[model samples]
Target: MTRLGRIIQRFQSDQGGAALVEVAITVPLVLLLSAGVFEFSNILNTRLLLSAGVEDAARYMARCSDSTWNNCVALGKNLAVNGAVTGGSARVTGWTTAEITVGKTSTAAVDGSGTQLYLSSTGTVDVVQVSTALPYSGVVFWDFLGFGTIDITASHQERVVGW
Candidate 1:
C-alpha cells in the first residue's frame, strides 16, 4: 500500500471509539439545553398567571364598596395566589381609602358612586433564582442547580365604574 494508505489505516484504528466519546460529551450538552428551555417556559407561565390573577383581583375589589375592604382583600387574595405564595408573602392592600385625604370633602371621587373605584392587588411567589447545580424541581439529569427561589411579586389596580 502507499504511505498515505498506511497513515489512514493507523488513524482509523486509533480512533475506533472516538464517536462514543463525542456522543458522551454531546448528550449532556443537549440535555442541559433542554432543561433550560423547560425552566424558562415554566417561568413565563408563572408570570402570565400572576399578571392575570392580579388583574382579576383588582377588578373584584374595585367593584366592592369602601366598607368591604376586608372582604375585598379576601377576594383579591384568592385571585392573586393559587397557593403559590405561601404564608404572608401574598398581600392585598386597600389604597383608595389611604389615598383619601383626612379632611377632604366627599367629592365626586370619594362619593363611591363614581364611574370607577380603585383597587389594589400584590402577590409574591418563590422562584428558582439560582439553578447552577440542581434542577428547578430538584432532579439530577434534570437539575437546574437549585438557582434558589425568588419572590415573584405583582401589583395592579383597576376601577369598576358601572352603577
Candidate 2:
C-alpha cells in the first residue's frame, strides 16, 4: 500500500482517542440531565412547602371563632407566609403575606355526582380557602429559557368549623 493509504488505515484502526471523543460528546448531555433533575426536585420541594403552609392556614381559619374572625384573616396570611400565626422566617425565600389570599366560599355539601354528602341542617358548608403564588427562584435563570417567571402556586380549602 502507499504511505498515505497506510497512515489512513492506521488512523482508522486506532482506539486511543475513541473514549475521549465519546466522553466529550456525552459529558454535556449528562450534565444537562443532572441539572434538570436537580431543578425539578428543587421546584417540587418548594411547591410542597407552599402547599403545607396554605393547608395550615386554611385549617386554622376553618376552626377560627367568630369573635376573633377579624384578626384571623391576617393571622392566616402570616401563617401562610411565615409558617407561624405570629410571623417569623418564611418557608420559601421571597415569599410574602401579600402573595397570599384568604377567601371564604359557601359550597353545597354534595359530592361530584350531586349526592348530598353532609347531613347539616343548613345544607351548605362554608369553606375557608388559602392560596398563594410564589415565583420560582432557582440556580438557573428561567427567563433565559424563554419561559418568563415560573410560579409555584398552591391552595388549600377546609370546611369551616366555628367554635
Candidate 3:
C-alpha cells in the first residue's frame, strides 16, 4: 500500500480513546453545573416559604392588634406548618432599634406616633432568618464517575409586611 494508504490502514486498525478523553473533560463541568442548579432551586424554594411565612405573620399581627409577639410567632410557625414554607428557622420580633416599628392603629396609639391598632411595621432583618443546607448528589454521570455530593448553605431574612 502507498504511504497514505498505509497510514489510513493503521488508523483504521488502531483505536483511540477520544470519547473517554472528551467525557473526562466535560463530565465534571456538567456535574458542577448540575449541583449548582439543584442548590439554587432549593434556596429559592426556601426563600419563597420564608417570604410567605413572614407575610403571614405580619398579616396576623396587623389584624390582631391585641396579639403579642408570641402570638405573631405562633402565626408564622403555623403558616410554615402548612408546607408553603420549608427548611430553615423562623421567628417574629417587633419594636427594636434595629427594626422599624409602625404602632398599631386600632390599639392605643403609641406615643410619638399617631398610628394605633392599624399596622405596626418591624424590620424582620436578621430576626427572621432562614438557613438551609442542601446536599446536591451531583449529575448522574458525575456521581457515577466519582464526584461526591455538593453542599450548599442558603440564608435569607424575611421582612415584616404589615397590612
Best by TM-score: 2
Best by lDDT: 2
lDDT of 3 by residue, 82-143 (tens): 43223444332211112212223232224345444223453121124433334445445446
Between candidates 1 and 2, which one is better according to lDDT? 2
Task: Quote each prediction's TM-score.
Answer: 0.52, 0.85, 0.42
On a 0 to 100 scale, what is the lDDT of residue 66 in model 2?
46
Best-to-worst order by lDDT is 2, 3, 1
What candidate 3 gets wrong by more than 4 Å, as runs, is: 1-15, 65-73, 80-163
The models' CA-based lDDT, in order, is: 0.45, 0.86, 0.46
Q: After superposition, which runs of candidate 1 have C-alpha atoms over 4 Å from their true positions?
A: 1-15, 65-67, 82-146, 160-163
Task: Output the worst ten-in-a-row residue range by lDDT, candidate 1.
Answer: 126-135
Poorest lDDT segment (10 consecutive residues) of candidate 3: 93-102
User: Which of the predicted structures, 1 or 3, would earn the higher TM-score when compared with the native?
Assistant: 1
Better of 2 and 3 by TM-score: 2
